[model samples]
Target: MAEQINLDKDDLITFFIHHLDKVYSAKSHLLKRLPEILYQVHFSDLEEAIFETIKVVELQRKRMAAIYELMGALKNEGSISGLTGLIDDSFEEIKTHQDNPELRDMSILFYMTNIEATEIASFQVLQLLAVKIRKERIKELIKENYNEAKADKALMLLITTKYLSTV
Candidate 1:
């Protein structure tokens, strides 16, 4: 069972800002982890894809910073506990597959796809908030971030199905 919560306009705005903070935190956390994950990945194309995505992630972080500036909510601190927990779980999963390169690569790809999904969902929510608040530039920025996440997900799927095929 679950309880329903009600929020006024101001509360909604605050909640939105909090989520933006969490998105920023998630990006920051990924930036820190990507290099370590990249080192473990053996495929050249997948490695290149991750290297390119690092640049995109940096840009997304800057865009989030701009949004915070726009909303005058730069000081807000938020928890990205879900993303952090996912990353922690991924590390444990990677450890279990260390003796097998194929399994490790597959694990990493699946983990990245999950991360991309989370980023896409987060950006979508941000886009909705931007529209509701009439922040056209912010909405556009969030859309671009969402598109990058989708592309990253597609790349992971392609690598998993095409390059890593066991058949």
Candidate 2:
């Protein structure tokens, strides 16, 4: 049987709050940037997938907001470092492949999946932290986002193979 972790609940809560702010901040930024990212792709399937991703992000933001309401924690007050670089790299990828539409579309898929993969790891951490801190409701909310991130990653993988065959 697995032993229960002996940790300072206060420290774990603080740690959870810090990352919660980071991910929520990142999701807010990426939420604004997603439409632009979606505009970069030309394929119907990829565009559809991106539209679904935007919907998932919107839901994720609301989920995090609910958690914040529960904790009485305010959102990040300043420019916080999180997933900005990954989003920027998505634009850069689009720009670099301008001469080739297929490559541009493919690169967008690659970078977006990269961002979602990072988010998956982040959400897993948030979930684990919630468990450690004994917040079952928050853990459940984060799990929805975590599972969506994983599903998006798998969908992106499927789109990659489809895009490649068409290329």
Candidate 3:
């Protein structure tokens, strides 16, 4: 995992893009298994929960799309290198935003807080793939250029509040 990344914002963005692609691929593979799970499970409640989770995945896909937009904006402006420098110069920016537990909680709640909240089978698959991608991305950052502390900080930001459990 540590072998795959360069320690720069552009590199990080590229790594995440690739990682997301892998995740999407893995999820596509897992989608085939969903029908089996859907069949064997007798509980209608569980079925609904699984359906809701799939909806959440769709929402997450949109979020990733937005992230890609930001990535594109950075690239189009020729700011990727500058952005990397900014990230390196002000590591505290990401940290300060993440340190507020209330903000973090609210953000997560805002995303998933809805009627009929239940455990979704699709979440397990998404969670596993997301974790793997994050782990690999961070490991790559750690190995190539950044100091241990900076690499660790980058990992923390990647996990953020939303992905902490998986991280």
Q: Which stretches of candidate 2 lie over 4 Å from their true place?
A: 1-6, 77-80
Return the TM-score for each candidate structure: 0.89, 0.91, 0.35
Residue-wise lDDT of candidate 2 within 1-167, one digit each (tens)? Answer: 99997879998888888888878878777877778757667788899998998899999989999998998888773363447666776777678998887888888888888988999999999999999888999999999999999999999999999888876
* Candidate 3 clashes between residue pairs 3 or more apart in a chain or in different chains: 2-139, 2-140
Candidate 2 contains a number of clashing pairs equal to: 0
What local distance difference test score does each model get? 0.81, 0.85, 0.37
TM-score ranking from best candidate downward? 2, 1, 3
Model 1's TM-score against the true structure: 0.89
Give candidate 2's whole-model lDDT.
0.85
Candidate 1: stretches off by over 4 Å: 1-7, 75-77
Highest TM-score: which candidate?
Answer: 2
What is the Cα root-mean-square deviation between model 1 and the actual structure? 3.4
Q: What value of lDDT does candidate 3 attain over all alpha carbons? A: 0.37
Which is superior by lDDT, 1 or 2? 2
